[model samples]
Target: MIVADGIIELDNKNKAQGSGTAGSVLVLLSTYDSRVNDNNAIHLKNDGNSGVIYAGNGKIEVGNGNQIKEATGWKIKLKENTTVTYGQGMAGLFFTGPGGSYSLVKGTYQAK
Candidate 1:
């Protein structure tokens, strides 16, 4: 869980697998405010075989050149403006709940 304001970047040229209910490689459980164009990028990638990444939880406000690359099946509950770019043959899934507001910039958005 990310509980601070920072950047998360993941560029993989290999295979990485994650198993579980969420299959999440990164989970944001707090606020990642980049409203002022801090250039903070949240890049989560799993380009390898069976490499699935997920973005779960929190209020992630990524703007001002902040980029995000999320691959695999996820259960996301975003509370801010964010962009998620996924790999080929993969999609981004957003979970619905109370206080869950996700404004996706791009990617395959699946409702779960």
Candidate 2:
């Protein structure tokens, strides 16, 4: 769900498993119209790698030692060895937004 100028509240957490697992949450907030806040967010998939980043032009603020992790989306199966994915992939999470904004990107990206 995409939201603007709204608040997000999550009290508990559940183990996620599926595509687009590792990702992030973008917080676009600007203060005094001078301090612009533009952060790309993306959720990692179950089979995706770590330290992936997207492209966006804006200021991104994050807490100390806070990083994005792989969080997939799946359904509960009653049968044995059953697979049910919500058909969500990296494009669903780290999709190309206004500027290719995404999450699940590693903090310390190596010089490349």
Candidate 3:
């Protein structure tokens, strides 16, 4: 449960009349041993400037060239047969129960 929060900028051509949306994004991620939950939180740079990789609650094993997050939620990393429950933010529940990556078996999206 890695909490990553920061702002992003959209640099489009002048032809576009409407401006882009920019704000803080809180991203929660975790991975195992490349078999179950194996991998980095995020490895890509498309459209983002500054942010923080909040790894406080749980143990955070990061890769190279990582950013600084706000560090809040727990950095959870479960192994084989490990089950995790996902809760809500401040309103409706997004994810709950075991699984990995993006999975929606019972017709419900486990919040990202």
Which ranges in model 3 have alpha carbons more than 4 Å from their true place?
1-20, 29-57, 73-112
Which stretches in model 2 have alpha-carbon errors above 4 Å?
A: 6-57, 69-88, 94-112
- Model 3 TM-score, 2 decimals: 0.23
Where does candidate 1 have its weakest 10-residue lDDT segment?
71-80
The whole-model lDDT of each prediction reads: 0.37, 0.28, 0.30
Evaluate residue 33 in candidate 2 and report its C-alpha lDDT on the 0 to 100 scale.
Answer: 18
Sort every candidate by lDDT, greatest first: 1, 3, 2
Per-structure clash totals for the candidates? 1, 20, 11
Model 2 per-residue lDDT tens digits across residues 1-112? 3222322222223222224445433322221111233222322222212222222322222222223322221211122222322223434444443445444447763322
Q: Cα RMSD (Å) per model?
A: 12.4, 15.6, 13.3
Identify the leading candidate in terms of lDDT. Answer: 1
Score every model by TM-score.
Answer: 0.30, 0.22, 0.23
Model 1 gets an lDDT of: 0.37
